[model samples]
Target: MVEAKTHLATKPRWLTPVLFSTTIFLSASLLFFVQPLFTKIVLPHVGGAPAVWTTAMLFFQTVLIGGYLYAHLITRYLSVRAQIALHLTLWALALFFLPLAVSAGWSYDAEQSTAGQTLLLFAAGVGLPFAVLSANAPLIQTWYARTGGYSADDPYFLYGASNLGSLIALLGFPLVAEPLFGATQIGWGWTVGFWALGALLLASGLMARGRHVRTVAQTQTQSAPSLKTRLLWALIAFVPSSMMLAVTTKLTTDIGSVPLIWVIPLALFLLTFVMVFTNRPVASMATLRLGYLIGLGVLAVVFSNLLGIHVSVWSAVLTVVAFFLTALYAHALLYSERPSAEHLTTFYVTMSVGGAFGGFFNSIIAPSLFNELHEGAITVAVAAILLLIRAVRPSRTALFGALALVVVILAKTTLISTFGIFVFGAIAIVLFLAVATTIRHTEHALAWVIVGFLVAGQVFVNHGTPLLRDRSFFGTHKIVEQDGLRIYGNGTTTHGAQRIVDLTADRPEPQLYYHRNGPMAQVLTSAKADASGTVGIVGLGIGALACYGQPHQDWHFYEIDALVSDIAHDPSHFTFMSRCAPDAPTHLGDARMVLAEQDGLSFDILVIDAYSSDSVPVHLTTVEAFEIYLEHLNDDGVLVFHISNRYYDISRPLGRLAETLGLEARIQDYTGNTAADPGDVGSRVVVLSRHSEGLGDLNADPRWTPLASDGGRVWTDDFANVLEVLNR
Candidate 1:
């Protein structure tokens, strides 16, 4: 209960904290829920392109800065009651476009840049809502201070709680909200929460009407921080925060976008902030220094071994660990140097600036500036510099020595890629020497030199476009050429490939999904067997299925990303559409929506291959999505699902869906290993048919077997239980 200091104060002691926590929790949760929901709604219009996330992030970061600025201005100019009223009024105004739906008639084409389109659409969808949401933490803290409720030291603790709310929202929205509620329900729930917050504000205002309004220390202090301090704080907060995102991009795109992959780095980043800000000593200088040295060394080794071996499950785990530990070290540093509550708005604003910088580098700038996701490498270097910036003792001289050693090592090893690993190890040794020297000046210089060389060497690797290809918001699409086959890969999934078989041929030969023996081949053959039968492809991976089509069959491609279509149709690349089916009907958007739109159309075979191999688009796996496939298919139509994963066993879920629907499904194990069953059998093709005769036909095939499932839970568009089926 929090009672006001003024004579008329009537609020209970627990009221303020309770209200504050709720405000933070509900607001953060609702805000994040909107992120995925809105993305899902407009996903079809934008073509589930990888870069969409990046574009959305940019909008979010920029808008967040604006929100913080608005909060600062309101705190400065308005009284507590006035600010509360103003915020309420704004809330009411925002409700006009309630139920949180995107504009109708929004159209996406195959030619648009997915990153840019997503940013624009997202900004339009929730700019005001985001602004309102971003201001909540700062405003509530300021309100607490104005009403003479808390000490200066208490505000940061509250901020930690606020972030806890953010973490919950991030975790829960994907797990609970998306699966439980539709977009309409999510929008309404958010609206209700917003109104509740407004009510809380009113209750607080009424309680504080006569309270003794003692000026807080923050309010009384008029001295502004120097420009340098402001700039430094902003840099410190912003760079690492943004770099965390950059690191996420690298790990997910360059490494893999498998579910739970992004969570690792983000969780570590948040935990670092928690440790640094808490009244705990877990973020000791010694621990951070050791962690930094180890993290940097590990990163160097990992990056240098980019192509030494194929990216594997073990490597993914190791990379996540490296990212988490390094990010923790860097972010903990930022938390250690956090500004006073009086300067919090400035601190947050600056943090947003750094975040924007990191995002810009990773999302927007990195694609054009360098090739690969140099953001991660760049972040490692930046983190090193930031770590050194915090040093106060005699390690400065040691830093210089360490820096010199790294420079020499890099120069000596520039010609050999593997030499980078040795350099990293040697740098760690120099860092240890710096820790031992007890000389401050030398450590600072060494730190600078190490940072410089690390960055310079990374840039050199990024220069000739050998290490990286094209990076967008969705992920990094690397161009790998092997034995004359040009491969375009996102995460671990080879989305597109072209063989340079004909050296003199203008267009590359279609490879991977577009190859002759792929799943699309079966769909085309079945469709060709019946000229009047329609064909529908659930997942449009570069429109590869269009290649196997005939002029007589009604061929339609359901693609989520127009960007993929653009890449596939580009004459400069493999011309699948032009060469195979010139006038193929391509529906741009989520396959589910497009399928639902076609009520009467029936396909002889509906192909389901929606997302990357690393990530199974959950919506596509749901019972509702399966029903759509069945409805669109003829009585004897086949539903071919491409279930290929290196980690999780998705077969059980498909089997369960088949059992639940009383449909018979058979699996085709396309990849077989004679050497040994490395437990990694690729591409389990689940063929489902409602008709028993169709099942009989599949049963006749020697490769087909009776699918078995526990028949536990069935996932729908609005409800799913992956926890039951997920691989532990």
Candidate 2:
């Protein structure tokens, strides 16, 4: 399309490439870095809900699409000089919003809505800066292509460079910036970096000045993409972009809602782009084909827990890997189908549009429409189908689609009920087989039929599934029954459970963390609230603790997620609240924010059970949080912390905090016998109180052990090291 510029003997070929690449790299990296930083700043105020990050991703993707659209319009319509002037002016205007920080004194209230508040915070703090930064990759590549440089004809390698920077920034921030600096300090550094990026972009603009482009040559030789090609580009981009968010939700739903967890899937997502867009791809076509097959298999295991089968923690790791590989394939396909440099901005704009749709569907729309995370399964199934079409011939595509459908059906059938899960799974498998046969026999007349059959099968199986499912902004909540045990699932992990036939003498039996033999029962029996004493509980899960409330003890539950509160209070989901404490009013929003509004010593006992289904809301576990709990409790009140977690050992930190305040702390690590009811699962509780002598029988009990003090360590509001507590 252009004369490939051969540098003279004196002129270095690498100089222009370095300058252009630096601008692109810095822009992309800074854009990715700010996402976690801004989201982290907003997390505590919003009550550390997982939905906060998901929704933030939706906003970021939308802004990104806007930036790409701007780039496309300017590049298509404006002269080279005009484009540079407009971008520089916008960059300078964006600089007016420097040192991004969430506006102070904004926290969710009873009157406040979570989704709107998050949007407000983002807009007030970092929206302009993010939008401006998002334009850099597309615009800079266009500029570089016009520079008459060695890499001009094929400036797409610059896209890979930009993505590499993004991946590094994502992986580095949690490991470096977050640990080393406070939120305010991180913003200052980010501001400095942004200005530096602006300077580099200015330099790139100066270097890329041009009076002519080979338009006549391009028109004569290269054909512009048709409308069909553009739409195909958008669809390809949609799958992985949406799937990334879906898998991220999957990860955080299982692991805690921390920045580190949020960044992993995203970093891998960026890494795939880096690989595929490069001159040499990290995963070749053959590699992608094999990896996708493995990814499809891993997708099967993720569904196993939904079907009531035991899931290894390994499954989560495999799922992450699968998403990475499948994404590599998707982006690789995009790279293969890339258009000429003249259509560069248009190509990116189409891809960004697809990405925005994916983000909206998974982050915003899916939570409201479907009760459970059918999106993840749907994404995987559709990806397998589409990717199969790309990887092999029509005959092979249908065959693989049939096999994948069968695999999903088989996974669903592991629940294997009489007229329920098994029957639906069998029907689905047969339907897919028929579809596959039809494709072979009927010359692709009914390929779209596979989509309908697959979707219908999923809906019916989901409908027939035994678990009582509810969708909330926080995550999917499911009450699943097997044998005599009813368990509460947050994602795939069981957070709490109860027995159907009461094995305990009590009418309302406490199961899982609240079992009679469990530490909760021991403490409730010991720290009985007085006639006027108020009991404060954080984290409402199935309202299980209501069974232990002393009559007329003035119980007030502080719940962050409103949806969780509804499910707990509703009789259909669990009767603990309705049967035990029907009139116990709940305080909604973040537990910290709700408590901050209260007068100190408003309760006799404060129980912290916010760690549910692996979602350890870190803000709720910090030293500042402990102080708030103490202030809310009466002089001799008991502070109970449910510290059971799959990865984080929070006991050490909790013990340290108790020691700091000179409060007496005891930990009960309960393990029930084999003959005990399955619902009465074991638990660990850290009990802290100022006056243990006033703690009734708990003071003199031989079973209770004084906390083995931690290594003088604590997580504060300004500082937290979640990675240090890895169970490994």
Candidate 3:
């Protein structure tokens, strides 16, 4: 064991590093919890679009950079004791804004930009919390070096521990916490945890300056890193990070609107760090990377059509593994090449800068610059760049030869049949000219040309094609407008729009799960039976269900995102809203709050359809939510829930809740139907009725079967289990 330099408090040589690392780990874990939870809180207010997550990521990256800058200031100007005192003071001050919850009164405007709204809201809400938390690694590690009495190299190890905590918090939230405790309970729990953490910071501050550090003036070494090194780091960090975002985007867009699936990719990403940082290097890097790249290639092949295959659950799992491995490799490189303890804060600051750049490129730049995600192409380029940078003695001849080959292949791939012979001939001439020339620095100059061309080609490819991509604050939205109908997609799932096509036209009609025959359609049709029945639709996808409405029934559509509503309201896209419910109500806010204020304005039927592209909205599935839905529904009214899923069975949770509330429930499994005959397709509609007459009517339909409760447990706001209901 390494001996302690000047031991006080009888702490062992290993104890300081261990404690500091653990403290940093816990801090990072708690910090990450903020990203998902904060996002979830605002999701109900913002339309559940892929752009929302991206915008939130961009905000987080920005705040993290601020925190790193603050950390740099603390280490540069303040002594160890002063730094500790300052941090503790900040913690105390932050308490003035706690129970650490964002104000609920924040209004979302659809006409304003999505990115702009996200930034404004984030600035007002948890900006300080995020900025302070972001400083943890760089600040605490510096403190460990100065006051905790450890060798400079020891602080970097703590970074691995910090990421470990990050992984735990990211995974634990969806898999454990959110399902076990409702969002409100989790908020309270995190508040208490934050208070305890603040106390620990105080304790750490008291012990900070009791003993002197080996006083060595490590002055500023501000020489900029090499351009190659900067580019290498950016590429390495950016690829997998962006790829993870891409996968997440696809899942929500292709799959249904279920929020838990978001955790799947994030958890896998964290697991990658855990595997790579642990002693088992081979398991982390080599095998994982190979498996991931192969999986990514396969994913491109399987999901390219976007309309053909519906591998929501299985593809989601595969994507998680791919993203995890790629992210692991990239982050591991960052850890391995970490700067010395003396430059710890600078190192973290640079990483944050790189991270911010990555988010900017993927969330803001790519959608505008490229027709497709181009994630795989970018990943390969980055991996190659990182490999080249890692090589100590890179050869000019070898490098030039590789570049020539890559250029040749790319040209052939881009224009293979049209100009293959001419392109190959030009490539051969360039190689021959290179071999004949004895010019110095030729290889370096050629390398720059190759890189520039690669980037330009990527941009050109996108510009030349009309790729139907749109960028917002959170993510990219793909628009498919055809036959007078416009379909808005985030990744793979059709989010919202309106139907403008003539129903009698001889074309492929939009049908399947999105048809009006689903549960939402049932409510619209049934509610029409009662004159002046007001119906509320939570999610407004293509306004497809509006077609089922009768003139006597009043319908109000509550949509959080303006982008979705804009596309839905447009007559050229899907005209369901304009043609069917042109004069009906359109409430622009959270359904919960909007419906709450409309006392006695009960609906004949209430439909909860907020989806995360293809996943279930967990907030709507809880008992408290059910109670809210009931409140909005008239006595003897029916509550219809669209429970169609490709993966986990949700019938159990709905069944358990219906049984608990004394409301008769039945499940209709419509599994193998098509869109042409929308009414004939297979779906699982969880129908609920408080009135015996309503239940009798639903049961008489032969398609509805009474929910069986053998050993099923109720899903209250306090608890629910999705794993048990995954069609085992």
Candidate 4:
């Protein structure tokens, strides 16, 4: 009987580790899983603007700061029993808002302040549950450290384990959860996980019932850390948090705004936490030697216009590694400077503040202040400068090791359009290197050359007046006139190109996507069977589709980006809208939102020329969005979609959606003639309608074949897998 009693008494030893670790892990997993899932649900409301995700990130980070503050205060004042009761009551209150879904009524429009509206939407949607989960790791760790246990000497390892769960949940959501389950199911799954976390939290508090025991480390160092130390912790946390958004924004601006793009950078962000916050840091000061040097080159390639359009997978892989390694070194430093266990919650609160500030600056401030995405480049340069300023007295082997890598990297040569900065900027870099080596500051000199080139090359190469330039929350737009053609550019991809020189006696020719004999032109002409009719368009790119507008016809345009609308409507940028549909009514909002509010069967034809460069605005391709178009169309109205994209195989998703919507669809590709003008580039468009007769004359042509949309491949408001349609 005594043996069994002793065995039961000793159970608390093993129970505490599992108790604390499981509570933190479950809390963190649900915390991150809610991010992408809820974002995916509300994405359609904002037209899937990349800015939506960025602004959402800004809100999330800010809330995390608040959550951490709550935790810090609770740790300072609340007794263990009171803390457990308060937290449990908070979780119980949070459950009242559950199943953890975004309300349909919680939405934002273009005219409303996007940041303010989205902040409210996200707060209403997931704020309560998130706050309850956010405080769990730090709070639990604090409680554990106050009690006695073998592992309590460093309850911070529980923090690392928490991030490990976060990493797994982030990567798993897109890779496994999204592809296999619907949005509602995922939300319920998260809710179940949250309940499980709550149960674990209760168990942890029950297990750590003894006040006679405290970790020796906590009891030994009860003095508060210096304010300077606290502030430094925040700044260190800020750089990586801010850069996390910057890197994600950069990738989305280049590629499409998708969940997979979101998770990769976030997954890396969590991984650095897991690696650096462990009982023993994986990002050792020794490993930081090479990591610090490689970061400069990573920044250079990422910001340089050299890899603008042709960012291959190899380059993408390099950016990911650079992002990871740069953050790892910063965290290694953070780990080394960590305050003692007594100041645990205070440490996390300051770190959260830094992260929150970084995200706010990148998502909210940078967009308003800079005319371009200068955050990513600026963040990398700042990291590089910070690194070089903290350079260690390296051994000869470490210096040579860095130099060897530099030589091998510079040896990689390509054409002027492909990595051609070598020829134009190599002189300055080499000169700096020669001076640095001749003097004593070899490492600083090498770092400066790379940093200078990245900043300067962006200015010299990418900052040209391409005529009209504008930056928005969406992305940067550079309108450069070339060969007498006005080109609407979003980063490296051309959104629209139109000839400034008129090709006809009266009207400006639609030379690019809307050429005279193109599929779009053929369909429009057939629909013009009546001299006067109503025509609606989803995207207003330089108003290229407006050239088909006749004097007798009424025209309406719904454009998501007001900047794109302004550029298209301005006569100086493009004469298409002025010459063709001068007085057409323009609606400035997302197609799904704006058109859904319009009266039914008001159009003879609808043209969707709204590809934001190579990316398809995903929300517009789903069954619900298609149904919106049909509602606004006349009985026999034609529904046109310009599906030309370099990085996405949109044919499959659109086809799949069409099949689900019970619409007849056909596709046509305009392979521009070699002898034609450079502005007369090839294009692809898909046309869909309820009946064969609505397709007009395009159906008679052999090029207008069927679009095969799979029922299984259909995209709806609740579920979409962008990975399913990658061109690769």
Query: Considering every candidate listed, which one attains the maximal lDDT?
Result: 4
Model 1 compared with the native: what TM-score?
A: 0.80
lDDT of 3 by residue, 1-728 (tens): 13344355476667666667667887888888877777776665555566667677788888888899899888788877788878877777766655555576776665677677777787777787677778887887777666545654445666667777887888788778866776678777777777777766655555555544533254334454666665666666666666666666666555533335555666666666666654446554444434433343333322332212244455456545545655776777766665556667777777778778767766677666765555434544444344434321124554445445434433443423234334334534564466346355443444333343334434433333322565444334566654445557744455544343453332223344545555444445443344436777886766767777776788888776555676667665556677777887777655665665567777776776665445545556767678888888878777777776655577777777787787888777766454454224565677788855665445576767787554566665345555566656
Give lDDT tens digits, candidate 4, residues 438-489: 4666546555665676766686667566687668866788887777777787
TM-score of each: 0.80, 0.87, 0.77, 0.93
lDDT of 1: 0.61
Q: Model 2: per-residue lDDT, tens digit, 1-728?
A: 12333322234778888888888988998999999888887777785666778889988998999999998888778876787788888888888887775566766765566776777788887888898889888988888887767668878999999999999999888899777777678888888998898789778887776343333235334578899889888888988888788777777776767889899989999988987897877755765755655464445435423333333355566667778877887888889889888788889999999888898888777887988776776776666557435333335564456456545544544433354446445644664566556655432322344444445545654555655777777677777777777678766567666666542425567677787787887877663544326787888887888888887688888877777787777766667888888898898877888888766447778888887566666788777787887778778778888887777777777777777778888887777653756666667788888867646567677777888565755677766767767677
Q: Please, what are the lDDT tens digits per residue for candidate 1 over residues 1-728?
A: 24433342555657666766677667766665566556656644554444555556677778878887888888777777787788778777777756666677555443566567667777677777777888777777766555555553346666666666666666665567755666567777778877786777566554433356444453544466688776666665555555566555554443333223444555566556656656664757765655555455445544544322234555555555666666666566666666666777767777777777766766777777764555566666665555555342224433444345434444453423465445454555655565556454554544454565455455544344532355443455565566555556665467765555532353334445444544344445543335535777766555545656666777777766555566666645555665665576777766776777767788877788776645546567878778878888888777777776654557788888888888888776665442342212234577788855664345576666677886666655545444455556
- Decide which is better by lDDT, 1 or 3: 3
Runs in model 3 deviating more than 4 A are 1-11, 47-50, 119-125, 147-150, 202-211, 216-232, 254-260, 267-314, 364-491, 494-532, 671-680, 708-724
**Clash count, one per candidate:** 39, 0, 35, 3
Q: What is the C-alpha lDDT of each candidate?
A: 0.61, 0.74, 0.61, 0.75
Per-prediction RMSD in angstroms?
5.8, 4.6, 6.8, 3.0
Worst ten-residue run, lDDT, model 2? 1-10
Q: How big is the positional error of residue 254 in model 4, measured in Å on the Cα after superposition?
A: 2.6
Ranking by lDDT: 4, 2, 3, 1
Residue 507 in model 2: shift from native, Å?
5.5
Q: For residue 530, give model 2's deviation from the true position in Å.
A: 4.8
- Best model per TM-score: 4
